[model samples]
Target: MTRASLVVVNYNTASDLRACLASAREKLGDAEVVVVDNGSTDGSVEMVREEFPWAPVFFFGKKGKV
Candidate 1:
């Protein structure tokens, strides 16, 4: 079976991202969760690193580079 990835693009929304990831973790079974951070200064990247270590994070450390 081919697995699907849930790509979530984020900025400075740490709280929101946390909630989203939490829900995904509880519900998404075998579906890879990928986070593409767009240079967030509000600790979004750090939060993901600490909380969702299983999810891969691709951080583009320059805002607006979507």
Candidate 2:
């Protein structure tokens, strides 16, 4: 069987990220969702870690998409 994955590359867009993830959870059932945070200082990392613990989050520590 084939597996689906969703990678969300974000930078200082915590609010939007929440909405996107929520929608993905509702629409994309059983899909693996990952978040790549580009060193956001707006508490995005914490929010993801706390709210979306199921999703794996990676910190790039830079201002570019990886």
Candidate 3:
């Protein structure tokens, strides 16, 4: 079977990310989701972890610097 991957970069925008993830889940369905969090201080990472637990998360310290 073929596999798909989705990479989402999050930067303190939890609402946007949530909406995006919802759409992605609806569309992709079986694809793997990868979330790269750029040191979000607004608890975006935590929300992603709780809401989208099936998706893989990668943490990168600080945004614009990486």
Candidate 4:
């Protein structure tokens, strides 16, 4: 278990999420980054998983085909 966690809720904002995660990583080094994707077709979940593999993502709502 992590001592702290950062929870991010994303919709179709993949680019923004990525930027936010990058900034978050720079700030919170040891904190856990948790992402909750709300059925984004813009491949938000996939981008996060691929780009920021350290962050654990919790998928919700409709899953994206992309």
Best by TM-score: 2
Query: What root-mean-square deviation over C-alphas does model 3 reach?
Result: 1.4
**Superposed model 2: Cα runs more than 4 Å off:** none
User: For residues 1-66, could you state the per-residue lDDT of candidate 4 as single tens digits?
Assistant: 567888998899999999999999998887899998888889999999899999998888775532
lDDT of 1: 0.91
User: Stretches of candidate 4 above 4 Å error?
Assistant: 63-66
TM-score of 1: 0.89
The lDDT-based order of candidates, best leading, equals 1, 2, 4, 3
The global C-alpha lDDT for each of the candidates, from Candidate 1 onward, is 0.91, 0.91, 0.88, 0.88
Q: Candidate 3 regions off by >4 Å?
A: none
Best-first order by TM-score: 2, 1, 3, 4
TM-scores for the candidates: 0.89, 0.90, 0.87, 0.85
Candidate 1 residue lDDT tens string, 1-66: 527779999999999999999998888877899999999899999999999998889999888866
Error of 3 at 34 (Å): 0.3
State in Å the error of residue 61, model 2. Answer: 1.2
How well is each residue in 1-66 modelled by candidate 3, as lDDT tens digits? 438988999898999999999999999998888999988988888988899998877888867766
What candidate 1 gets wrong by more than 4 Å, as runs, is none
Point out the worst 10-residue segment of candidate 2 by lDDT: 1-10
